[model samples]
Target: MRSEPVPAPAGDRRSRATAELTWPGKRVGHHAGLVPVPSPARASWDVRGRLVCGERADSLLLRADAGVALAELLAAPGAVDGGVKLCYLDPPYNTGERFAHYDDRSDRAAWLSTLRDHLLLARELLAADGSLWLHLDDSEQHRARCVLDEVFGEEAFVATIIWQKRTSRDNRKAFSSMHDYIHVYAPAGPKVWKSVRNGLPDEGAFSNPDGDPRGPWRSVPMNVQAGHATAGQFYTVTTPTGVRHDPPPGRCWTYTAPRLAELVADGRVYWPRGGDGKPRLKRYQSEVTGLAPFTIWTADEVGDTGSAKRALLSEFPGLQAFDTPKPLGLLERIVSVATDPGDLVLDYYLGSGTTAVAAQRLGRRWIGVEQSARTVEEFTLPRLHAAWADAPGGGFAFGAF
Candidate 1:
């Protein structure tokens, strides 16, 4: 067993109580103003409840302080040395609202200063090829972007993804706000980043009607857009059906004459039997690249606020409602795009643990940090435990600073 001192009280000048906490086979000692500790630790309980002492801890970690946990992660040798693949954060929006545990009200200077500190630490934690996804509302997105540009540099800016967070309009307000912005940044430019592709949806359009030996295929237009045509793209062609055609009024052939002839010889061009339709290119399913991720994410593509609330209610019955919990589908989409299986993901705010849950479902390692003991005990930890029980492969360790 190891013993350690509890943290000193914050902003209290009076003489304070102090106690030692023992771990690895003992109960934690009670101290004034200390957060409530869990019951006697067991084999299944990997909750550290204090700073981790030794190596060989689980990849899934739940820490009680963002600053302490981030500092520890950066200081740990080889733990996060150019290793973290993605850092996704959904910090408090500073909307001047009161939550169950913390107040969202902060002066502009204090809020920006706090965010700047966190962003600086987070930038250090990112690998050369790593990316950061910061979620925020319109209230402070511009300011946040300025801070990010300062920390990560203007050249590191990637994209601002707009997520449609709601479907129904609010009747009380003059303008119903229904979207949230997710700012993405990379330590390095596009060369070090990987492109994210969405799975191809099954459609009846793909069919090998002619039984081509290659595979099922679909016909796509063989003309470039009106304003995007190059000089070499303007051409005339005669199809196999003996029909002569020229590039459309403004549009041009998608391929040059030589390329078109080569494709025709290779049986990759499709000419209609009627000899009247325009030539088309046969896009084989085997050669198709998946759909690239786009900036606008509709509610159907990811999920809405209602779905998120229902998911939380279903996951943990009798739990108090969180004011703004992100949908699992939304986080799942972000994780799927930003990382691969076994990559490290960090969520500092960890409001309802949606990020951790999404990472777990996708078979990625994750770390979550939250300051509220009530949240960790009642919502985050239990939700993660339930997710693990449902899947039963990966486990997590809990710690405090």
Candidate 2:
């Protein structure tokens, strides 16, 4: 990738910085904070640096600046126009909370404006089959939905995943806000997106009770709704116990007479020894793909805030810079569902860099952008370096903008 800095906007504070910063090596220690510069032309501020990892060096691209200003950094020259497979964002929730490096408080208009600007630019970076996962709480989810509809269009809207962030109830409030929403959108359309499935807990549910050479298999109903059934699908099946069975009430055989006969001939039908049992189709374990993902995500399936905090503490023994960092499991689920190995994943709101770590662990390419120098130096960069070092392989480049 290129190491040259993106041309600074005219009259911006960073325009005076003659040399752009670039760090291109194996791995390095966290550096001092970027000195703030005044901008006489615009209210917005800027930082300077361009970190680039060589093609065979590392699988990470990290930028320290307002993610809103690094569109060019993400979409480098000669790269695919819309190559990003997944864009996961966890921007400030406009909760009026203050952090060590950045402020989260903003008026309704200002907050929406900031989000809108970033999302509009992010949409351009998405591939035709790419998806965006926006993490937020009830504070502004409704308003944000309207904004997303405007940017991605109503047709591109996907499911809103409700993740249980915490397990305990907040007795202080009448009702506890224990969950957060992950708004998913496909910029091109949902059709271009691939199907995502969750891994099954165990293969014990599939067994070869019948001792068929197929190894292991499960049984499923062999009936279809009568409303959608055709005349040829109405048939009778006889069990090994000499008991004849017909479709119950408003259902018909799932297969046509010829198909059912073919299945019976192939020994693919499961006929029970008992007279009361219905015949079922044998579904081989090898033929099964995976379970479909649901809208509600429990803390057990993913991880909770308590677990995330503990994980962060383990990653960085003494530091306590982040209040609500997402668990690696959560981002792993999002990345697994949205992108494949080697696919490009982007996280502009890099926070504690959990998304980058998760993507790296899963063997996917990643880009993380954060505006806070403190978060980058203290939490995100350190955690990422440790993860990369401890793991078998991977590398990243750090840059400022």
Candidate 3:
């Protein structure tokens, strides 16, 4: 309900960094505040290593390990504050099933205890200009909202993205739930965030239909409102070729006379012989970023289970334990909106490693924290390697280098 948006109180540091990273020629950037381009191949505990950002970390996947235990991470004794633009924590929804390597179906008491610690660590790791996205369902959304408002502060609440993860409902009960929530929270105002614009529709709307050479375009209605004096409002517009037409009495042009003249000079208005005799504006596809996205994620825009499964399966044959993994498109949008090309993204739950895969696909650096060796070793890693197989740098080669 309450938000505190100050003007650049974060000082010259954030401004300098933003300018440096987004500058036209300065993009395709270097890793900043990293733990030194991870020599994690050399780090191996007796248990298997969960390789992330080309380095290994301890795993905590499995029902028994689901309880939050972050003494080591917090007891960092002497840690530094390298900023975090965004943090995505997708914890188990207490779904009563074993996912990947995690068995998180615990009793209520234990679950709340773990939840508290999870929120604690997330708050600690967050940057002042950064935000946190926690994924959950109706069962815990209200409860989680209370906890998050307390932790991240009620004022920090952004929008709750309702993602429709399915095409239809289960229909098992009177009303089945088919949607999941992607809750967004920021430490401060939205200065450090970016919104993604995807590729245009395939309708060829951007085409130079009239061969104007400027690019593709579609006819846009030039009249958006109506005038009171219908008779006086209507007037005839004649083309150089002698074609004539008049607008409706109440209708007025979208652009004023001067603006309409400019469009005519630019050859963007259509004056075909028609009943209304009104002019329409031409909107070039090249002139706009694809339509913006809404908070509700659907199967239509992103992919459904079939596409997601094939994407993972193609990379690692016979590796099929995790179900309901997100498609590249879903995570693709998340990464595009949340982080830049070189920012660090962390997804603790890391179901099928969608966030990590998306980061890689978008040329951003990322880390996935899952407790399951199956997910880290078998599921997440192989899929990523395959995705990057044909890329210029040979895509995501892990290890010392």
Query: What would the per-residue lDDT of candidate 1 be over residues 331-383, giving only the tens digit for each residue?
Result: 99888777767777889899789998888888877788888887777788778
Write the residue-wise lDDT of candidate 3 on 173-290 in tens digits: 7877767888887756433332321332435445565787877777777765564434333456666566665555557656666667788998889764543445777777767654
Off by over 4 Å in 3: 1-82, 98-100, 107-113, 123-131, 153-156, 188-204, 223-279, 310-320, 388-401
Candidate models: Cα lDDT each: 0.72, 0.71, 0.57
Clashes of 3: 8
Candidate 2 lDDT (Cα, 0 to 1):
0.71
* Cα-based TM-score, every candidate: 0.81, 0.80, 0.65
Error of 1 at 330 (Å): 0.7
Error of 3 at 389 (Å): 3.5
lDDT of 3: 0.57
Candidate maximizing lDDT: 1
* lDDT of candidate 1 at residue 38, scale 0 to 100: 34
Query: How high is the lDDT of residue 365 in model 3?
Result: 54
Q: Is candidate 1 or candidate 3 better by TM-score?
A: 1
- Of the pair 2 and 3, which is ahead by TM-score? 2
